[model samples]
Target: MSRPARAHLLSLDEWWESGEDREVRVELQEGVRIVAPRPRPAHARVVLSLATQLSDQLPPGFEVLIEVDVVIDPNTPATVRVPDLIVRSTTSVEFPITADQLALAIEVMSPGSRRTDRVTKSSEYAEAGIPHYWIVDEDLSVTALKLTPGGYVATGFVGDIVTSTPWPMRISLER
Candidate 1:
């Protein structure tokens, strides 16, 4: 007997409808479906901490969301991604927020996601024209990047006090 062929990719709507009752986190990248591992305690801590800080300090028209799917390219539904946290304007709230509406996408690095966060996701976000991207390392160091005409440029790296542009907020990572 021959084995059945497997699906290598899923469109955004398909993935969403299929995953509605599932607990596993899934993301689509370059026409492929990827299963994301559950965040460990340390990773979850950073995610919540950052989300809380951003949500508390964001301006009136902006809001912070956790693990929300962002559609990088509506034409290619397989290009959806779920960032650890996203900062977006609240003026036009919508499900599966598009990349253009997002002000920032943040990823808390884990052993399994270091490369994806630093390289693949960075490139994707830049290509999608999201203005800002941040990577929070295991040690709590943060690397902030801003989108430019050429691509994403590292704006700053901070471990203690974080003060960056495009968002009028300061965060201290000291514990």
Candidate 2:
């Protein structure tokens, strides 16, 4: 089936009010709507487990948020991404928190999203200066990256316990 195409570039507000946003698993990146396949049951399970685990060990002042639209840039040609999880400051009470308030952005890799998570998102998150990014595999091992002036560098660990920064909290997602 053909998806309906919008002619104009979308801002954050337009994407929110446009009923199309509610009708699908869509992300708006640089003003275009990107539709992704529904996540499989196993993928959803990992996301849930991570959210619960992360929240339990969360440091003071930070909170773990499940799939919610993260406003990367609120301009007319907007960029919004809904990651599997986002660790953000508790200070921001808004529905879609801006990128600066994000401490870490986590992506649980689904089969269809491997490349997008590994390559595309890492670039975008770094550009947004989110500081840390976690790429969780299907088996639940995490590869964490730390942002630098140039880009993200692998901060991979030795075992099940993985830690990220802005604050130190060890996360064990091992099965």
Candidate 3:
């Protein structure tokens, strides 16, 4: 008889515990591993620009997080991530993001990052129950996505004018 497909299993807790010694950021979803490269200068610029703009517009008690790991669970499938920009309305923000704490997550697509963002992370964020997830493509000049009960659905594309409110007020994205 053919051997059953060999399977390797790891609790999500182990994944988070292991990330401390790794070189780059790693996240897990249902025990699957994901790795992403460090941001390039242009990518960094976009993240910083958007972070600054959002920070300025956000009201008190809310804050913008930059390149920090957002832990999505505390159980065996504990998923952790470092999104480009995370806007939280909570007075205190901490790691291990639960379903309710996370308000919005924005990812700036890097070269060749379309598949990962549009597919992998998209599914994972939805599973994590993050309210709003936006994927920003530098080349296409587009900010796309809308969170739904199942996952993120590509609803609209903003080339020059992008408006949303993770914070109390509206913030726009140009270019």
Candidate 4:
């Protein structure tokens, strides 16, 4: 049998206290601590490229937050997560955010992020009612998973170019 998953037992508040400590970034979900892999340059490049492309289309009132904390729930801390890119309609609050506060969450998938993006993070985004969730797969050269009640509905891939109005920003994702 496989070994049980390793998790840090801490509340969302505690995670915030040491958010940037660098040992690990912990997100509480269903009583489990998900320590995301350290971001690589490739991953950062994809996130920045996509953010820049989308930023140009954002309305004056909207703002794009890069690698920010988004609290998905007010009561239980189980759903708190930090998405790579978040498009918010307004600039409100400083840190430690709630899910309903965002319009869209974009996750750029690196080589090792398949399971997290497709499973854990996807579940959290949907359950929190995030209107749009983009899973940009560098491997497949596609953007998968449009948010739905059951799960992310498969949308067209970003082969050459992708045009989406997932939020206030009209984004184009291409290689």
* Highest-TM-score candidate: 1
Error of 1 at 85 (Å): 0.7
Q: CA lDDT, every prediction?
A: 0.81, 0.82, 0.69, 0.70
Structure candidate 1, residue pairs in collision = none
Q: Write the per-residue lDDT of candidate 2 for residues 24-47, one digit (tens) a residue.
A: 579888999889877778888878
How good is model 1 by TM-score? 0.90
| List of clashing residue pairs for candidate 2 | none
Higher-lDDT candidate of 3 and 4 = 4
Scored against the true structure, residue 68 in model 2 reaches a CA lDDT of: 88
Instruction: Tell me the tens digit of each residue's lDDT in model 3 across 1-175.
Output: 8999875545756765565634665666555567666678888888887788778877777788887667665566455666888888665546555546667788889886788777877887787788778788876354555677665666455544345544344335453
Which candidate gets the maximum lDDT versus the true structure? 2
Q: How displaced is residue 130 in candidate 4, in Å?
A: 0.3
Cα lDDT, model 2, residue 167: 66
lDDT of 1 by residue, 48-167 (tens): 878877887888998888988888876644688889999888885587689999998998888888999999999989999999999888877888988899888886556663564676
lDDT of 2: 0.82
Clash count, candidate 4: 2
Question: What's the lDDT for residue 150 in model 1?
Answer: 88
Give a tens-digit lDDT track for model 4, residues 1-175: 9998875555666656654646555566654567766788878888888788777877778788887768876453445677889988777665556787777788878677788888877787888888778787876355546666676786765444444556343345543
Candidate ranking (TM-score, best to worst):
1, 2, 4, 3
Q: What would the TM-scores of all predictions be?
A: 0.90, 0.87, 0.76, 0.79
